[model samples]
Target: MLRKHLLYLTSDHLFAYLWQAGSLTPGPVFGADAAGLRAFALWLADGDTAPACLLADLVEEEFQRQLMPHVGGHAGRQMRRRRLHQLYRDTPYRHASVQGRASGGRRDDRVLFCALTSPAIVNPWVAAIERQGVPLEGIYSASLLSGALIRKLALAQPHLLLVTQQAGGLRESYFEAGQLKFSRLLQTAGHDGMAAGIAGETERTRQFLASIRLLERGDLLHTVILAPAAELDALRPL
Candidate 1:
């Protein structure tokens, strides 16, 4: 069967978009409640409950990423996961997992590691989707998907930041050499006007990149921002 529907589930909203032959057709965005979410998703599927890839954009501020020395094969994966587990043992999140991909052009074949502090909120949706007969092809976080976009963009800047507006807040994903290095969710809402609020958050993200050494003093930092046209225009000058 051809899987063409993409569902993006965030903390408060669920959005359905169409995907066909490398193009995306944006659809409706609705609440995350089972009734509404299922209705819209089925509508997008043309009332068929066939399997589709659920590209979940989780808003939980728990995703972490890093670059590490690459080891080859299955053993390498195990080693990386173990290292990530150890790193998060002291954190408040009790459950987590590590996933990695090879960093580009590194002579030593270093890999980029991504650690996710599992969101407990998504558990209910898992059952909801199953009950509704929506076959779940896969669930993914924004950080992971953003990496693919960064690589696809083939940005000239080695270090860059991508900020997208989501239901709960602004989601920021950091890319180094087109590899996902870090991600965070800023819950900045209603404190100020939309434009200023986003601008302040962008500055904070830049500082974060600098503190982590992903950006150096006076180094060119490129940002790819995804927002509505009005707010996007305001961000253009920043």
Candidate 2:
């Protein structure tokens, strides 16, 4: 085992993390207010004892600078930036802490940011990076990433796997087993955007489950929704 562990971090009212190679609870969710981001950055960067200035630059300049201004708000944008700044000041941009140690030995860590803005809001940031000749691994829809976690944990071993996605033009379910697999993307538009969206989506899920059940003549139930928290919670996979 090469031991690849994924660090999935979402920026929410509190940030949540899941470090998975193997473990239940996946990983515990942790809170990261303005002060916490620096500590987190240090952890992500591993302990290198770089000056606070350098670390802040790494975050603001490298990670958040582009995402900040485009957020567009006379009132909130400055405050968001200021809070992010304060996080930088609180400590070095990152540290390494896995077993409750202040820091040490974080040679391998991938820091993923769960951006709040939509692609339309954040995609332009990439242009600036490209202008500076910075390379990127790739970009993915946040909804897609969310859906992946469920499939990885629950469906990886199943003979037939299905997953649900609920974003504009991103509604879908997938199937796979052995070397066989294909994706089914559904352009399911609900009468009420995403609020009453679930009603229509749930109905579609029911049809999918019913059809699969009939085809297999056995329980082949499968589905996962990667939508807003409220929407995902309200939805019951059919």
Candidate 3:
């Protein structure tokens, strides 16, 4: 059985974990600094050749939804690439994916463009992996993963709001018909005002969605909160 490693990255730290025998062993947590990067490089050099999957839960991420004329084959790929570059020219972590076609008119393709805007937060860790010749499976965003979570949990709502608490903050990702439309992270202070914070943030998100017209007339927003049982207890009344 091949060994696998997982990396969870946030603004302040990068958590490393080793997966063996269906169990995950916690490894070192590296600070996002020069000295930490050096230590991470040394740690990777300890003869572990396992491939890694990096999951980033950073605040500095962007998402844009655009409609473009449907073009298939190689041209479509080039067009999406160019559009991604145009949307986020300065970031190398940009990606675009087609989320089906539009309803009417030209029936254009709906493309979601996203990027990890902070290179300083990610580049060093990625560079360290490259230097060590470790196979990087992929760099994934937590917001993007919420779409899959909704699907896995069988939340089949037309407009869904998925809220998850993470080390960095509270992540609220809005999805339309199972497609991720946008996401935002709020830096929460301790567990003091947890329920209130979630309520306030969730309302704010709804207003923002309406302002942007993501919510249509009489559209119901099904909210799914992913948290521990204790947190859920606190949120149940809200």
Q: TM-score of every model? A: 0.72, 0.30, 0.95
Worst 10 residues of 1 by lDDT: 90-99
Of 1 and 3, the candidate ranking higher by lDDT:
3
Q: Which stretches of candidate 2 lie over 4 Å from their true place?
A: 1-129, 139-148, 156-170, 178-180, 184-219, 226-229, 232-238
| Candidate 1 structure lDDT | 0.65
- Listed per candidate, the RMSD to the true structure in angstroms reads 5.1, 18.9, 1.5
Please give, for residues 1-238, the per-residue lDDT of candidate 3 as tens digits: 4688889999988999997787888999998888989989999999588999899999999988899999999999999999988888888988899999999999999999999998878899999999999999999898888877888899888999998888788899999989999998888874555687888889899989998899977988988887877777789988
Q: What root-mean-square deviation over C-alphas does model 3 reach?
A: 1.5
lDDT accuracy of residue 227 in candidate 3: 80
Q: Put down candidate 2 lDDT per residue, 89-156, tens digits, no spaces.
A: 43222221111111235432222122232222232333433443433334443333433555565555
- What candidate 1 gets wrong by more than 4 Å, as runs, is 18-30, 33-46, 61-69, 84-111, 115-118, 188-193
TM-score of 3: 0.95
Give the runs in model 3 whose Cα sits over 4 Å from its true position: 21-23, 190-193
* lDDT by residue for model 1 (1-238), tens: 3647777777777777777777777877777677775676466455566566765566454544455655677876677667666766543322233344444665344444443345455665566667667777877666677767766767657778888776656778877666666788766673235567766777888897889777899887687877776675677787
* RMSD to native, candidate 1: 5.1
